[model samples]
Target: MDTEQQSQTKSEFEREPVPKSALLGFKSFIGMYAGEHCAGTELMLGPLFVAAGVSAFDLIIGLLLGNALAVLSWMFMCAPIATRSRLTLYYQLEKICGRKLVILYNLANGVMFCFLAGAMVTVSATALGVWFRFKMPGLNDLYPNSVGWVVAVAVAGGLIAIVAAYGYQTVAKFANIAAPWMVLVFLVFGFVGLRQFIEATGTEIGSLSDVWHLAKTQIWKGGPPQEGQVKFTFWHVTFFAWFCNMAMHIGMSDLSVFRFARKSWYGVASGAGMYVGHFMAWISASILYAYQLHLNPADTDVLPGPLAYRAAGLVGLLCVIIAGWTTANPTIYRAGLAFQALSPKSSRFKVTLITGAIATIAGMFPAIAMKLLGFVALYGLVLMPMGAVIFVDFWLIRKFGMQSYYAELSGKTFNWAAGLAWFVTLAIAWVLVKFAGVQIFFVSLPGWFVAAILYIVLSKFYQKKLRPDAVQ
Candidate 1:
């Protein structure tokens, strides 16, 4: 192979199983998950929970259970398949869903990734607004409020894309470097916010009970939601915490990440992220936002830049920027892989750079980030059916008297069974959320079972029609 060809092959193990030599140790995933999960979203989500009227008990216990579930899903649902197959989710889907159908899935997956990365960019940009004294968007504000905000997003997103275009090892290295420092900064935010609350409320810090008392009465008071915010209960908090990263864990997007793992058990490293980022970081951030609300009720904006700065000063601002960058880097890399899967001939480096550019453009629009609570729920729901399809195809299809990887075995360009399982499950999810009055956050739970069953039943009929002799 020429030098150029070698570089392209090294871009990612796109069309092939990752060689044994390329497999990563457990620490890499620990760092990556910790850095990625304890990120810009934490700043937004922590605040959003308060906006949604989550009580102290609900937020605390709910996050405990929800994060535990998220780790298990990553361990059992995603990592087993990733380690066994050592293939990217896109490539694995192509084997089962066929080339044409996989293209549709990739497009959806990649676009969602771009928008998500864009939200992170918006988060980082908010930090810049504080320094430059630019007008930032409000909780309900959708469009770019100032030219400075746009420029900030562009700079942050551009740098993130360049790093992502270098590929996975680089992404992991960046995460490792940032994770420890970011974790400490987040802790400081909690302490600073707690001190402010204590001073303002005149609460005596006698014991843990006092802290709980402060948390109950002042921080998360269990009141009605702000205008336009959804009311959140314990179930809502638990489900949101569990399924917030549903796309990455249950939706099987992390197949690309975990495919590099030496053992499926490495999935447990997600706990480092779940506990530190999702649990501690979220509580800390919510503390800052809650303090802001305590001081003034009318100021109902969810801006991380100002929120962090108020807690830790310049250090807090820097944390917000770096946190967003670390998260966006791997996200853009994954999005690039999804896009590259569509046209295997395209260069992943270039595709990633382009993908980052798209995310940057998206970051200029505040709608996705401002309405992040709903958007994250919807993002996971749209992609989650595919995960169910993957789960069934891997573990259940053969037991049901059907051939697995039907598209690959039959040389078909489109596997209608897999395609229908994806689309039909989504259709049912829509019905439940639309007319049946199921919130988007909760719909994905039942939807997963529905997709699994749909895939099995549809595969039985599909295989019988296509290859009668192949069906037992």
Candidate 2:
């Protein structure tokens, strides 16, 4: 089972590839990607689109194009490489970039995963907060507001972490149980909110065009930017949708997920997420927020709990809690794997438990969850260059007369070419954001190309220098 944690006795595949006996079916991937994508973060991200003041046409059209691109990237770029190589991103990177470089990568990957898992925990806490009546963070909140908020987060995060520490089987079972019900709740949110909108506005909405008109004028009105938010356009929506999962697909992080697949075509399974979670769930959640704004324009808080409660009542509330757990559980498990990569001799349970603690502490603060829009963009950008490196090493290095895995072949502790590619590409991305007036959402597209080209070019020079007799 792909979801079950591999046996503890299994090593890092230092000897052979993942056996064919271990490969999983397409349905496994469909469930996994859908569960991961249509999860707690969707609750956070869907409302944010409305906050950005996106138009009906732009938001709708952009998501269509962007999600298609994400699905294609998964099928063509991520899956083939993962299935062919049959190595985890960590093991593969260690081979190409060497142990010293991979250590730094693992540390960064671990922290990023923890913070992301923490955000999901925060989402779960909001459901509890609804019952406890604890102070929840508003849109602009940067810190934990009350002791009730703190305790809610700690308790929520602790439980999520404990489940993750038990390994992938526990995480998988939890997600499978929750995924179907949560997805149903998301759909109910859309329909209930839509009915309310028609009733509230007294509009004669009877056809698709009526819904389209409502989408433009009443819901996503293409208005001026909200206070402390950016105005989103077609390009912004398209790019953000595509790049939101940049680390997982374009950056090869899902190499971990897809490595267990029976066939590369299983990559198409991500469509379950792009359409279900990113499309329907996002639009539905937006309807809930739009309705809230209609009722009380002053209540501009992007809290998912209140929004969901208004739509499906109690079922929605319970769904939010379970959705957040299923989402965070796998992420925490992945983070645990990253931490375990750093100390191969350590037990995964201990490292994962400790990683979960870090996430719980992070959940106490509202900044990570409240600022999720920017944080997700930043997370994808930071991790993307390594993915580009993986791509280039897999396909282009040997064609360029450069030896792949030069660091491993030569017994070096670090590969400067890979390091330089990572650093230089990030520098270029930073320059684009800081000086070129490029938004974070659009920066990774060009940044990916930069990392790919730089890795190939640098490998030629860096490797040749290491082997004086080698030709470029």
Best by lDDT: 1
Count clashes in each candidate, considering only residues at least 3 apart in sequence or on different chains.
0, 0
Question: Model 2, stretches more than 4 Å misplaced?
Answer: 1-15, 19-22, 166-168, 345-349, 465-472
User: Judged by lDDT against the true structure, how good is candidate 1?
Assistant: 0.88
Query: Looking at candidate 2, what is the lDDT of residue 101?
Result: 94
lDDT, candidate 1, 93-185, per-residue tens: 888888899889888989998999999999999999898888888877889888888888889888888878875566656666777899999
* lDDT at residue 302 of model 2 (Cα atoms): 82
Clashing pairs in 1: none
What tens digits encode model 2's per-residue C-alpha lDDT throughout 1-472? 3433444213545334677877778887887777668888888888888888888999999999999999999999999999998887777888789999988888888899999999999889998888899888887788888899899999999988887887567667767787888888999998998899889999897799998888898988888756877788999889888888998999998887787788998889999899999999999998898888889988888888888887888988888888888888878887888788778999988888999999988888878887787788889998899999999998989898778767767677799889999999999989999999998888899999999999988887788544444324
Model 2 scores a C-alpha lDDT of 0.85
